[model samples]
Target: MKIKNSLVILLVMAFGVFLFQVYKQHQTQGSLNKTAAYYNTNTPDEVGASNVVTAIVVTYRGLDTLGEVTVLFLTAMIVGYILRHGGKEKPMKNNTSEILITAANVLIPGSIILGVYVFINGHLTPGGGFQGGAIIGTAITLMILADPLGSVKKAVLHITESLSGFTYILIGLAGLLFAGGFLDNRILPLGNLGNLLSAGAIPLIYSLIGLKVGTELSSIIASINETGNKTA
Candidate 1:
């Protein structure tokens, strides 16, 4: 009881400190920091992306984005390895509802289309590769839930993931060789802003990212589901 009370008191104190910090925070002046000012003034003209956040993420901080994807890939690999080696017992099965199966059929196609749209237009819109990939993963999860015994082609997913990652790296190297730096978006002509083909290589890079992320996530989910299906 004393330990519980102590923990509660500590949590309360932390919350109080957070609240104090929030209260003490001052409103920003009209002026931006140097980096922000630079991006604001030059991003549209230089990056040719109306979406400043997309420009910064896909170009200015692209190497960091690559690291983030690599981390996710490692996580998925670890999960699959662990699950594959885990002990298997007699598998328990659950019956899925007809309504759920029907719903999956109705929604999966639209979800995939929306995911593709989001990544393809990452340079011009609010959504990007990660968001689109998550949507695709969700659709796969829904499909699994609707039919647990259904097979997902692991080979195809693996190939897609590998190819996308390879292509992404190639594009980065192209930027380093032909453009200003690694992962630069100016390897190709920056089309008119707000168009589907604008933002130079951003859309292509983001599409590759979406494919890699989607396949990785799906592979992880499929591994988990297969383990569950096979385990007793």
Candidate 2:
């Protein structure tokens, strides 16, 4: 088995080296294609985003992003399945210090606010829905730790996740019907370039994504915590 593993690693390394050499050979002869130039130069005007990265991700490649979000949702479903068997466990008595609980209560609101800010400005700033969602998930973790007996509502999370996903799909369809193409940012009127309302549909889509992700992750965390209590 060790010999087989070594041979497999060697084969993979050699294949990677061969691919790298081929890429290097082509790199010298290749220049920026028309598509690349167009994406680089015209993305801002076309997508109405000061953040080129956001434009490419949520506008030019929106379908791929949606697919990725779907995969995450599937993962959440799997986690829910695993946690189902342990859901009968009663919540453990809270042992967290009062100070810790109070501090968490104070900070959770701020974390949620920060998460919203990140997703809302995704088209104009560095952060986006994914990052923002993770932040909100962290806040959920704090909430669980602060009061273990105060269970997070799985039903609420489910509703939030479903609504956000449905909204995202509706927005994509709207773009197809009303704009230049599917996931086009021009469906709604584009406001000022750097303003909060400038990037049509992108911000709304990202906000939905953030909410979906945050709720899914929170549900997963709740499930895991419940499972842990059963084992404990």
Candidate 3:
């Protein structure tokens, strides 16, 4: 009875905290802080990206983005290593529904194409590398769900992930060397705004990010699926 009362009190306190946070956010709504105001005022002239959020993420705070990707890579590596050595392989049961299989076949290609389009035009649109890469990863996940025993080419994923990460770093280094600072998009011509080729190196940088994120996510999903198969 004492433990139950304590639990109830804890829950009420947590709920009170949540309400306080919500009220605080409401109090501060619709206000652009100094950082936001600065980004909004100067991002167009400086970064040339129509998507202000992407400009901030991929350029102004690019080192943070690099660290995020690095963390994701390490997570994938750890998950793969642990799962790969967890147990011996066993044949996966083929219990997937035909509807799911058919849907995966039909949607995977379109999904991949959309992912590519999203990352390539990230500077001009609302979507960016992370969103696009997640879409690609979802498609691969769907494929895995459809066929439990299907083989994913880990070698290709590894290669693509490595190359993209390497190229991403090189692009950042190029910006540091030739332009304003690290990951500065001004290394290449900014070109005409709103055009496909505009935004200098942002599109290229986002493309590399998309590829790296996609491959890393796919590799992680494949590892999980393989381990599930072995355990099943």
Best-matching candidate per TM-score: 1
Local accuracy of candidate 3 as per-residue lDDT tens digits, 4-75:
999999999999999998888886458799999999999889988888998999999999999999999999
Clashes by residue pair, model 3: none
* Residue lDDT tens for model 1, 1-232: 9999999999999999999998889677788899999998999889999889989999999999999999988988899888887566555666899899899999999999999999998988899999999999998899889988766888888899999999999999999999999999999999898889988999999999999999899999998988887744
**lDDT (Cα, 0-100) at 179 in candidate 1:** 98
Write the number of the candidate with greater TM-score, choosing between 1 and 2: 1
Q: Which digits, one per residue and each the tens of the lDDT, describe model 2 over residues 34-92?
A: 87788889876788888888888899999999999999999999998977787456646
Per-model tally of clashing residue pairs: 3, 0, 0
Model 1 residue 118 CA deviation (Å) reads: 0.5
Candidate 2, residue 148: how far the Cα is off, in Å = 1.9
